[model samples]
Target: MNRRVLVPAAVLLSSLSFPLTITGASVALPDLTGDLNASPTAAQWVVTGYNLCFAAFLAFGGSLADLLGRRRLYAVGVSAFLLGSAWCAVAGDVGGLVAARLVAGVGAAIATATGQSSLASAFDGAARARVFGALGTVLGIGLAFGPTVSGFLVDLAGWRAVFWVPAVLAGLALLLCPALPPGRGSGQRVDWAGGALFTFGLGALIWVFVEAPVLGVAHPAVLAVVVAAVAGVAGFVRVERRAAAPMFDLALLGDRAFLGYALVAAAMMGLLVPLLVYLPSYFIDVVGVDPARAGLWMLVLTVPSVLLPGVGAALAKRSPRLLSTGAVLLASVGVVGLVGIGPDGAPWPALLLTGVGVGLTTGVVDGLALSSVPADRVGAAAGLFNTARLTAETVALAAAGSALTLLGGGQPDSGFTDALRVVVVVLGCAGVAAGLGAHALLRRVGR
Candidate 1:
């Protein structure tokens, strides 16, 4: 294959595996609980473990790619992911599976952190925009089909089959590794101290978000984690400012346009990811659909995602600010549409709206973030952009889950409906606020 086709194909394949693991694993959770005799907490970790590690190590992975050669790191990451997947497939208990997932998440972090930058290195100008759009298309397809595929796999082969899917994808990605253009490491030495502080800070922060809903935000343990996370983040900022080669370029934050684009990415993820994670359950438990059928229902949110990336790419060429503002506003309308969802409610309209909003904004915003940074620093910039997006997703999930628990009042039916309404309303407001904020920020930058 041509290097142009080969590199992006490999990166897209690797990128596709991450979301597949996320959505497919969620579908497998009930089966895992039964097979492993796991508690709700343990099952939750099956999802959280991967996300936590992925978020924590993302910047490290990107920095490493910049320092260690993107192709080499990409290969290493895929091999690790394949090994972790095989481990998960064979694990006998939830604890073992969770542990395996942590390993897989590390690999995912490395792969994802480098995936876009690799594309950036490979293509530029109109070609870059199209490739980025194509990358977005891959993401949407993975998310759209993940559940349905996992559902069939689980029904046919069992939950372990879900693990095997990513394993196979990783193996194929590894085969393409040699085709990637040679990547040179940045000559700068690794900032180990800065990396450690940032990792621990982000890790603690994510932990608090993941645990707060279960433990109560005011609980001593949660409070302690919060303080530690805060201190670690503050210390990390101090360390980065003083360090010769910081993991993140603190200087980039000064560019209001860059910051605005980053915020748009983060905010879009905050609204979209939680819905993807939770809506399948709503379809099953609330709408009384079987798991397999619920997967089909999820298409309402995911299908639009697959169809709109090209539109977003086209819009980006004309005006990214317009793309960001319009998409967010449209997504807010979708969220509002979701406010009254129930057993008899037709969710497809709201789902389509939300999906279109997210799909239209993501690629354009991602392109903006990448293009705003220096070429050599693309890896680091990708890490920072993704970190912010994932953090927002983690926090949104925690907050939404907590709201559900509080509003549900222990009643499975009515309580869940009430909780869903509350969460939808909040997400809607957030979408509007993010749209307006991005618009205002971009205007300020223009001024």
Candidate 2:
């Protein structure tokens, strides 16, 4: 009931909405394709556009919040997101839908950029941990619930309903901002030039990666995009080094522990997001389940993901290295189990373990990422963490599309095996790295 708690309470809603929309759309895309008259390639953009923009601008969003007032930006972002969702809900065609998704992504970046800073500005060590724990729970649940929730909405009301849910949440966040404390930023100059360069660079790179599957990696458009992306990055780096106040302080990467945490987050995302991306494909194509039914099965995988964080949060406080151990163990076991899955169809229990593993890793990873950085640098830490994770997310989603195209075996069984194997190997390696990271930080953050 305290306004202090109300801040994260409101912020958590925004965090929850991010993944819900991200994962929810994947499950609903099948229906969306038909209703919107979209092609397979265009459907990919529905998800890609959101993530591309989310990653491109998230760091800048954080800096902007620090420069501008958090309250002002939160209101701005939530309103924009709400308005975008309205557009998506009534979008008439694939082009309209993709554009709406891009708009929604911009809104999400605003909310995410400021959400953690607001929480940190409002709370301290132990309380911060608890709020973060709850945020983890919210994230896990949003992702876990997205498929099932979207499925129900799509089945009962239509795909448009999925867009409306997050829209309403954003609108409520806008209303609750008045109850929150005043923001601390003094409206410093935002690195618009730096932000523009980074946006163009990252966007171009993802554009190429996303199109590779459909366009052929060797296609002229793909090559051109890749070139533009590289040039964009070079330009961004040069620009940032000279900017009055760069959007991202590349110097932050000089902090070994901080960079390690960011990499782990990236690796964790690379490991899990891909698995989730491909699972829907298996449910629909291999299992021959309809979109609604496939979504239900996918939700089964996410249930543990939704709840494990609450447990992991408590454990993380008890042992700085505890979640790291569990992250490695769960991911290994889950991926190894997946390696044995065959064309006959996956066993239900194996599927469940995979989801459990995902939840375990995500929860612990989130906790460590924030805890490892200095208190004053939570903004940089949170921004770097989100950027790395979002990059992995964009990669994972695009890679699945690319992997399937290359490994084309005409069956979801073959596709699933191919995709899961790569993810399993990747996560297995990440688990080891996370363990090393925990060990390195064990003495640093000394219990």
Candidate 3:
């Protein structure tokens, strides 16, 4: 096999490490708490802090990749993640754990922001699409199996094993960074004000959500968070509109193709990842299953991860445009399945539909998001894409948390009806929008 072909493979393997770390850590949370003597509320911050940093910095991380060069930044990112993982392994308390998670999140953001951009640079036409499909499989596998993976490691060796794995993987990726492209920024200012506003706003919003279940909605902390997330997001948008060489070129919005593509991403990512995140929660918290057993029942979701990409790949090869549109619509159908299921039921079939929906959407989203971008702007596009999806995810998580609080939390069979209703309605709307978006992209691209 050609060494040139092997290069992208190497880059991808390195990229996989960060996402694995994310999922692994979440599953290990129960164990982490006992060792560190953390409160349930505080232990949740280990995940929240990573999310806070990751969501805020994604767009900026892309800018850094553009300004510095993907390879150099990749090395920096992977190395930082490794160090942070080690820091997490040895952290003495909640404060220290949160700090390590924050750092780890920054490093992970770099990987998330640049991985697709790097691949686009490495391949073209059909090959680029194929690479993304494979990337999707890696993503699906990592996400779907995170709890299981973390559960295994945590049970066998300990939760610390989860931290150890990423450190080693990141270290290896750092060693292989030399083969990537040299830096190619377009001489733009870094948009610090925009970054700060985004960071502060999102951070506040997340603080509100993660804390809300523990701190009642009436609590000052919750109120302040709600207020700040709104204000910060608005200020960031205003600043971005004024910035010279904005961190995210909102001008991409003017390109109807980019706009349509991004909205689809926002909705799909916003809905899909969180649905998966909370699925196990639904099983354990609602269905009254064992935590370990609840993870195995997720086999419904995990099995699709192994097989669906190949099916999606075949569809894309035949008609990338319509297939992406159609795949998006399938998510709506899945949402309906969830909404229609009874509170008296196990939701097994509904969850299976959700898995299929996720399978259909992931590959299609990957294709449309990357394929629609002009090659010259691949890095910028990737960065912007990551920002949009992360923003969507942040919103989804916040909404899910808020909705559950309002609905009176307990079993998916009981409390999740309203929550699932919200998920279905919003996701259904998102699906329609994404289908039309793909059609628009196809028309604009003259595919």
Clashes of 2: 0
Model 1 lDDT, full chain set: 0.80
Judged by whole-model lDDT over C-alpha atoms, candidate 3 comes out at 0.69
Clashing residue pairs in candidate 2 are none
Candidates sorted by lDDT, descending order?
A: 1, 2, 3
Score each candidate by Cα lDDT.
Answer: 0.80, 0.72, 0.69
List model 3 lDDT by residue over 304-376, tens digit each. 7566766766766776665566666666566556766443434567667656755755656555566666777
Candidate 1: where are CA atoms >4 Å away?
1-6, 115-133, 182-187, 316-319, 373-380, 405-412, 444-447
Candidate 1 clash pair list: none
lDDT of 2: 0.72
List the candidates' TM-scores in order: 0.90, 0.85, 0.80
lDDT at position 254, candidate 2? 68
- The alpha-carbon RMSD values of the candidates against the true structure, listed in the order shown, are 2.8, 3.5, 4.2
Error of 2 at 361 (Å): 3.7
